[model samples]
Target: MLKNIVLLSILMLSSCSTDRKVSDKVSIMLDVPVSPIKTYFKEHFDFESFIAIETTDSFLVSDIKKIVRSDDNILLLSGNRSVFLIDAHSGKLKVCIDKCGNGPGESKRIIDIAFNEELGQILLYNDFYKLLVFDLKGDFLSEVKVGEMYENVTCRRGEVLFYNKLNGYSCYPYMLKIYNLKNKTWRTVGDDIKIDFPIRSRGLQMVNSKRVWFNAPLDYKLYCFEDDTPAAHYRLDISMAKLSDDLIKKSISDPQTFFNEVSMGKIVYSLNSLRETENFLIFHSNQT
Candidate 1:
């Protein structure tokens, strides 16, 4: 069963405004149809047999929390503060990191994990507020202290991008905390705008191998960083439903009531998740 899965509709916008001076605002009107929920199951999915990984004393898995694929290895994070590297094809355990202590090369809590294929390294973010580095063979190399706590972390081009919220008026300028692995320093990116409410911001997203994209949770504008500065990309407009400032403020105060109202079709909720590709921008709405 797919839990908390959102069905998204992809929309491709025509024409690209590349002129540095041209306004980067594109309005799109969507006429979404309201339909009832339905379920369907097919019997034959290539008639494949399932191969289960046996749980033994050496390969004990207790509640697999997250799985990340890197080449031929499958990295599984467990709820018991352990990380296991398994072979993707043979379903065999390669190495497991289960050291849960304050000693060196150990972590009390694993917040997140990312793999760098180019460097052949595994980056682990832990509750100690540090980023631990290990090779593909599960050997600890080094660890770096991070400045702030982040909910999401991603690495690209030798730089680690951390996404988290800042305390202050919503008008603060930037939210991204970028740490340079080579220079051993940190910096911020994105534009300063009114943050009317305290909400989770979707931080840096990798557009390609080098570029990263960003967008505010409350705003309809999409931005991409060009040399560490945010440049306007596109804007979305919904014709069937509109969100007003009053509704947004209410959502900040009482999210449960706001979601209840959105479920009842009283207001069109804000865009939850936004994703983009070379040609199209995809997103889902709260309206069923």
Candidate 2:
């Protein structure tokens, strides 16, 4: 009788543990959508009448600051020295400073900024194998290097994927690199992808809670990826102009509740002026 009782207790405990794990995962998922901001922007920010904002004139002082837009925010990389985080919706500059391993005479020399949102971190690749990571606010985290030589870095929400090329004129398949944030390690994935091209433009952006989007410069269009396959494509209309810098700044400040109170299926347009800019533009979207 005691043996049977113990067996029942073990089964109950196992079931309870599984239930707890599932409950915890569901709770976290409920707390935040898989790609809340990205989905909203994709749905709402159509090409017709969008505004742009200048996050920083770092280029004004020098040619160091380059703005790279992620799924939810814009990153200003000052060479490899410092980084600035801009709010995607409002264009407000949140934080700015140097990142990891402080250097007194830093020249701001980062080759690329890749955001692994799932890991809540950013990857900075300096040289072929030299890489560093930091929080969103220029805080030091960790650093590592991989392979022999690679010119660029590409990243998604959970992985920093890279590729390198061979020496000389022969453009052959070299190596494809993958780094895991959970394990904090690097490994080779496949050798079929050539290293002739830099890995800057290739990335996967999460669309909605259950969908993902992919952009390839070679294709020059945005594609929705479902179940690891191409699902939908959005072609640009040439008549629509890009957003002005002023509008981009505003959108960056508060993206979460920025475009609410509008229909989610049809395109809409709006006009707004910025704090210190003259020109005005319209923002059109199917999501608000």
Kindly give the number of clashing pairs for every candidate: 2, 36
Over the stretch 95-146, how does candidate 2's per-residue lDDT look in tens digits? Answer: 6655344342122356556677776676776643466777776666777755
Candidate 1, residues 149-267, lDDT tens digits: the string is 65556677777776544444343323556777767777766533446555443323222223455555555555555555556666655553556676677777876766676566644
Compute each candidate's TM-score over C-alphas.
0.65, 0.44
- Best TM-score among the predictions, by candidate number: 1
Q: What's the residue-level lDDT of 114 in candidate 2?
A: 65
Q: Which ten residues in a row have the lowest lDDT in candidate 2?
A: 6-15
Question: What TM-score, to 2 decimals, does candidate 2 have?
Answer: 0.44
Error of 2 at 257 (Å): 55
Which residues of candidate 1, in runs, are more than 4 Å off? 1-67, 166-174, 192-211, 225-227, 239-241, 266-280, 284-288
